[model samples]
Target: MSQPDSVTFADIEVAAKRLAGIAHHTPVITSRTINQHTGSQVFFKCKNFQRTGSFKFRGAYNALAQLRLEQQQTGAIAYSSGNHAQAVALAGQLLNIPTTIVMPEDAPTVKQAATRGYGAEVILYNRSETNREELAQTLAQQRNLTIIPPYDHPHIIAAQGTAAKELIKEVGELDLLLVCCGGGGLLSGSAIASQTLSPKCKVIGVEPERADDATRSFHSKILYSVNNPDTIADGARTPSLGKITFPLVLDYVDNMVTVSEEAIIRTMFFLWQRLKIVVEPTGVLAAAALLEGVVKAPQAKIGVVISGGNVDLKGLGHKIMNYEL
Candidate 1:
């Protein structure tokens, strides 16, 4: 197990305090139907209802809120497919810090519009032709802007851990906790929180099967990566875990699993109908794992983190119309 002494429960507490009154203490909901189907006491931590419609707001706000005056004046740059872009943009707006985001040209139109709506200047690039990180770094240097990385930063990870902290505080200890894995920020962060608050809980990270880099890395205990996987879950389309997140995930997370694209879409639609919540495909990955029996723990207490709900309705309608599941 590789441990970097990275994020800790104490850090999450600090972030929670920082985010208090500013960030919504998102609610946790339960489903009797889901509980009956899984035969477990299921708790759904709904980050979808958070500001910017995702949990990314916690990290983005925490990181930006703690910036030095100079950094705030110079502003910051971030590169994200969707959620992080909107998060940073909104956070920057709240903190009066200018933000520039490098996003894929094909990123969800809703996300792109939200980022711009938050007042950040968005630079779109072809994912096949350009590396967003390098572009952000170059822009950062040229503009004297800070690079607020989407994940892998200690502040970001600690900030993200606050979601699981809130969940555990609300629901008490759990037997199993399932988290959606993107670049491993939320996964690793949630595991860290579960470790301290619910020592007996087993934390598992779930991803889309088409973008299973984290799963591969977890099983082999070796860093693995993908190159712009074509999964409908845009958030999980990250190439791989980061230097910070990879080690944190290897050390803290108990297991990793991946669900099919069909499972993801099916779960999203199911949640919309059953829970009456609009969960994006990426947001429902952890729920899919539990609902579809990809990772089962019969009769045990379970917690599933719904990461976000920023769906492109038009695109999702097309996907739903075409999907058999």
Candidate 2:
């Protein structure tokens, strides 16, 4: 069985301290409309407003800030679909560490542009032709750069846990904590915090139906793999949970669920229309589970993390305009 030796609440506390001035203490919001609709007192921890427009900033800054002086001088490299790329790029720029990001050629143009705008060199590769991680490792060896993975690292998970810590602290306790899962960094990290802080709270991870490998793995207690899922929730398209995250998830998470693509798109539009916030498809997975009645918890005090606001408006414009939500 995998364990959370890689992360702990204390580690999250340290990470929170490291991110105090650097990362945004994003708002914990509530909606009477949503509460009325779902019959639950929902408290949303809006990471959409976080620096770099996602919770990835916390992990990125924490890991980069802790890099050895030698590693910092030599710089860092990373592979990300989108959010993590911008995060590392911006964090590297802030920390005066040079960064290089390997991104999919079909990644959101907005994300690609933001990554480059942060002063990181961007390298695009065809997903079908090349393995991103291998390319990143090769490049890292060539450049003597540290690899800052999207997930699968201790610092990353611990830092990601800070969001849950913040939510629990501000909101007191939760009956349920719904988190979106990708590589399981946020899900496992949040579950660890929830289990420790609000022991009674049921921590559930949500994924797109098209990319339900994590949910499948959770049920079977075996690692499962998916190759480049074609879901709108791009962040949740990771092949499978990471080595560290898989065990942490198995240990901490209470349940796992999947939401249909219609549910995902509908819930995202609902947030935008009702909450007046821009959340990407991946960001709405957890909310989709809750709002679409996939994980019904009537009258429960639900804590939901609205993960990111980085919508690829340029590329997904048509889909957004005509999404009959």
Candidate 3:
């Protein structure tokens, strides 16, 4: 999928309309400490507070809503680590469709259970030997299920754009906006939205150092992937950029930066300790960029997308405590 010459303002508006009552119009949070420390008045679009504890729900529900009648009846299948799986599962439940999710055997138990609790049938595969895409395709072919790609579809991008629409409505205008990149759905949608809503604002993407596909793709002007990433940010661990989203990121995204695993972990804990928000590792990368000075904010305004909050408490505690162990 080549890059779209332009993802228009109307496209984003339509997406906002499609997601109007279905997806959460999540709140924008402000903190005096964040403002003082970052040296900018930060507006955090807290999708972590969104249903399914991730912004993935917005895109998933929107994509599901746009599916043809036949596709809906046929049901949908997806492969995801956690948040996206749960989002698709919940969306399928709400739309009264059968959902099947292929997750790695090593995926966080909390996330796996949450997806199942949403009424989707969960299939576990060996992360090391099986390719998730191949598994998803096999299932789709066998079950006659429509594949709802995690972040590659236009409908998904449109749906994700609504978060920016809501943010701009609440924060007026921003000089710079930061979003964490996984498969580039949220980042691509954010670029489209920021371009439309605040034309002068620069949209940047943050990624974990271990899964810096977006950053590499931006510099190489080609798509990149990590076959098997080793990071705690499971949501941002897509092996490659989508054919559609890669071009979108290359063309529209102003900059892409990476943060260290330690930085990501520190930022996650900072939000938990200071902002009193429980965010997943991927969700914390934007804040990590700010805290680590990966990209200094432009003075006008700053908006950061806090993507998800579905961390396993016991596991997270273990990670934090056992860092040196």
Candidate 4:
């Protein structure tokens, strides 16, 4: 099937309307310590507090909500590492649709359990030995399930934009907006919204240094792929940007940068210790960039997206205890 045209700002607006009362308009947080550290006034769109503890719920719910009656009755299928799996599962449960998620065997146990708890069937595969998308597609065909892609679909992209839409709406204009990039859904979607809502704000995409496909793609002007990256930021281990998201990122995003795994870990600890908020490593990507001085604009009003908080506490504790600096 042909991909839909790039998601437009108008599409995001419609998605915001559709998601109203369903997705949480998560709070925007600020920290004097963060402001002092970065020398910039910063606002954090804390989607960690969102239902399912991630912004993925916005896209998942919007996509599931728009499904036709026949599709809804038949059910939906998706592939994810963790966050999207839980998001799809919970959205399906809320909408009374059966959901099946294909995830890596190494995905966080807490996330897997949460997905199953939401009444979705779980299929696990070895990340190195199997292709998740192919498996999900085969299952979707066999089960007559509509594929609710994590980030590649226009509806998903539009839905993901609602986070930025809500942020800009609540915080007013910003000089810059930083988003964590996985498959580019959130980054591309937020870029679109930022362009429309806060046109003067430069939208930047941040990624783990190990999983820098989006950053490479942004600068190289060509799509880049990676084998699974060995990074603690599991959500950003995507191979590459999708065709739908690539162009959107190229057109609307102002810049892309990467931060070290150490920086990600440090920022996660900082947010937990200073702000009293739990942010997973992936959720701290944008903040990592700013705090590490990978991307800086002193004295400017900046917005950063804290993407999720569905961390495996035990695993996080182990990392924290073992990690140095």
Estimate the overall C-alpha local distance difference test score of candidate 2: 0.93
User: Tens-digit lDDT track for model 2 on 89-180?
Assistant: 99999999999999999999899999999999999999989899999999999999999999899999999999999999999999999999
TM-score for each predicted model, relative to the true structure: 0.98, 0.97, 0.96, 0.97
lDDT of every model, 2 decimals: 0.94, 0.93, 0.87, 0.93
TM-score, cand. 2 vs. native:
0.97
Highest TM-score model number: 1
Error of 2 at 233 (Å): 0.6
lDDT of 1 by residue, 20-133 (tens): 999999989999999999999999999999999999999999999989999999999999998999999999999999999999999989999999999999999999999999
Stretches off by above 4 angstroms in model 3 are 1-7, 321-325
Better of 1 and 2 by lDDT: 1
lDDT of 1 at 171: 90
Q: Best candidate per lDDT, number?
A: 1
Give me the displacement of residue 261 in model 2, in angstroms. Answer: 0.9
TM-score of 4: 0.97
